[model samples]
Target: MRKTVIVQDSPPSVRLVQVGTEQAGQRIDNFLLRLCKGVPKSHIYKAIRSGEVRVNKGRTSADYRVEEGDTVRIPPIRLPRADEPRPVPPASFPVIYEDDAMLVINKPAGVAVHGGSGVSFGVIEQLRAARPQAPFLELAHRLDRETSGLLIIAKKRKALVALHDMMREGGGRKHYQALVVGDWVNDRQHIRLPLLKWLTAAGERRVRVDAQGKAAHTIITMQKRYGRYSLVGAELRTGRTHQIRVHLASSGHPIVGDDKYGSDEVRAHFARLGLERMFLHAGRLELPHPLSGEPLRLEAPLPPACLKILDYLEQHS
Candidate 1:
């Protein structure tokens, strides 16, 4: 959208601006969120719902995509106090691989990928602040905040689009390592379940196995079994929210320390055993290079605590 040229400092008023190529296709709410920095999300949603924000001179919802040259009317919003500018903390993460097109990071548990749901800052926000010179950076996939390991970030728009396509078509192979609560009897198993996302009575997001839900596929391969736990490799053929965790849990073996799906007793027991975080890790990612025809297999070793738990399980079991 047209930047400072449309708004004057002293004489602030309703400004109708034309969308630019770079800003095109972005949801008006997101566009407004960036433009109206520091404004609370509730205010943004209310403004859109109240028709205070207009696209192409017509009232639009928050999900409407802004087209190039489309006129967007932005209401005069109160700016955040000059003395209290919330800044994205520039934090560095362990870098696994990096190139002109993509970057791979071994993300740690408890850090959100992007801020929302009470999180003030996430990997993307921090990465943007870390390198102000970088023009474009976007997450290619998501990992649960409590899960740690390999994550991909695209440095170019084309790369992001290609990665999305690869993931959507099931061309990319994503595998995670999880320590479950019980021994895995099968050497290998394919789980084809329809998963439906629903809100619990407490308004928390949850997924359940339902015939009416979207199709999801996961392949569980037995790796090693402990006296009371099993280390399994989960290969996802279709990516869905909490796919691996939910699939394994549905099969009667919830992941250890998975507060969302695991048994409370098991989680508590594992926490007391020093496995404070979810015992799942995105240990490997394999796909053809988006630009190059060459094959690419990226791997991230489990964190020290996870390895120590595995060692303990091995030695004790």
Candidate 2:
């Protein structure tokens, strides 16, 4: 059963018998934990810590004093797991931006950009399946499986060829936002590192900065600071495989939650801080329209999970 109460100086009335509790003196968190046994403890603690649970229509700490006959307002509980499956479209992507030659989408993380070895379903394939009448869509760029952001797709072969030419000629720009370890001493710095592409022990493609590698450069500026970590804005001068991650790692500050270049100790530290994935995102992109030659800019906001972690750090630290 659910209960609601209005905020007033007088304590609201709660019928303890309704919730199978006639006892008092239990802490609010403890009582709620008992009342909602199926919910994750972490989530309950989070809500309590965030002041979402209140006692007597007033904000109370998790350890607040509880008396008999006191009223409590329990916010609607959010289930840990999804309750319904995502709606899958019969045809192509939900286009966020479109013009005569190019299309953009809020590409979800965990979906590959193109088909590879054993994978048959990728963004391209799904688009084709949904829009059989349109010719095959071409990728203007690629994003890793764990990254989410605006993605550009070319509708015509000529458009793809032209975009590729522009990128090769250093006519395109890309910017990323990353939560990295360590407090940057300088407000802005440039990383000029060469990257060599190689396969990992598990046969996954990876890149590292080496003397003999292809040239890569990125400019980084500090956006915000949270104790040992800082949110940074990265502008790419040249596109290379894992360029931002490699350059930042080489500079002695790997991105937080980065499993590839960061050590296990660093990963564990971030985990303890409640980060579940690599603290990196493709924040924005800028380029000329493939056919019209007009400039276009696209931006994506940080995901809620990422922001939640940041908020925790800020409040606790």
Candidate 3:
């Protein structure tokens, strides 16, 4: 028998893809990044800018969100063999709620919502791998890697769009539990600070309170006092990045285990007492169901490690 070896490096010709409900709601650049597995982002943008890529036979901007049934023309691009996407391992999390439209899970601390910024894969990728037959699954919002609790995943295009609109209009409630350093005075206080996102000299992302920044508001209520530390409930009115953390820090009480905006001495002391991660948990959420518009409330209790830290604080206080 003669051996026949096939070469897999041939560049594909231009193709037109009709966007489906499962692939809708994402920007054009992002859609190309996924469709062209090994193509560089610069090439994707260049193609979009030069009219090589088109939607409905017309050039479209990179930020344009693809809709269902829209035909996207993808230009041929050579892919290096080594740059192919690696296999994503299938994984699952503790499901708090699940319907045909959406999935809510009790996400743990230190696990990212999606893969990027040096992370190979995250919750969304892993869940997709785990449920290979799933038509659509996308993150409706985001939580910091160090924050643990209820996270929502949209399983349908309608649900994703509805959730995004609800978040933009502040139609729902998002509550978090935080253990912060300092003896907070007010029983309840609203911090209306403007925050601007900037990058450090080393290219690290950081947020700071600035007069010319976006409006950020957080309602803080004193839950308990532990001498030098205070347990507080944070209700977000504006969904800015690191809004809760920066607000609490500006009030002279950074989250206990937060490395970015916390005091070294305070964090070290808490570390000695078994506080392993940032003391921020998305403990509760209330919103209307995306499809049905019915009232819905979701909750995730403190994990074992967080409970242990609370126990120590209570005992010491």
- Using all chains and alpha carbons, the TM-scores for the candidates as numbered come to 0.91, 0.67, 0.87
Poorest lDDT segment (10 consecutive residues) of candidate 1: 2-11
The lDDT per prediction is 0.85, 0.72, 0.87
**Candidate 1, superposed: residue stretches over 4 Å from native:** 1-12, 81-83
Better of 1 and 3 by TM-score: 1
Output the TM-score of candidate 2: 0.67
lDDT of 2 by residue, 124-239 (tens): 65675566565336678887766667788887656877888888888878888888888877799989988999997888888988899999889999999988888898988888
Query: Higher-lDDT candidate among 1 and 3?
Result: 3
**Number of the top-ranking candidate, with TM-score as the measure:** 1
Off by over 4 Å in 2: 1-94, 268-274
Clashes of 1: 0
**At residue 281, what lDDT does model 3 achieve?**
98
TM-score winner between 2 and 3, please give it: 3
Sequence-dependent TM-score of model 1 = 0.91
Residue 79, model 2: lDDT of 33
Per-residue alpha-carbon lDDT of candidate 1 for residues 6-61, written as tens digits (9 for 90 to 100) = 32243246777777655665678877776665677788889899998987789999
Estimate the lDDT of model 1. 0.85
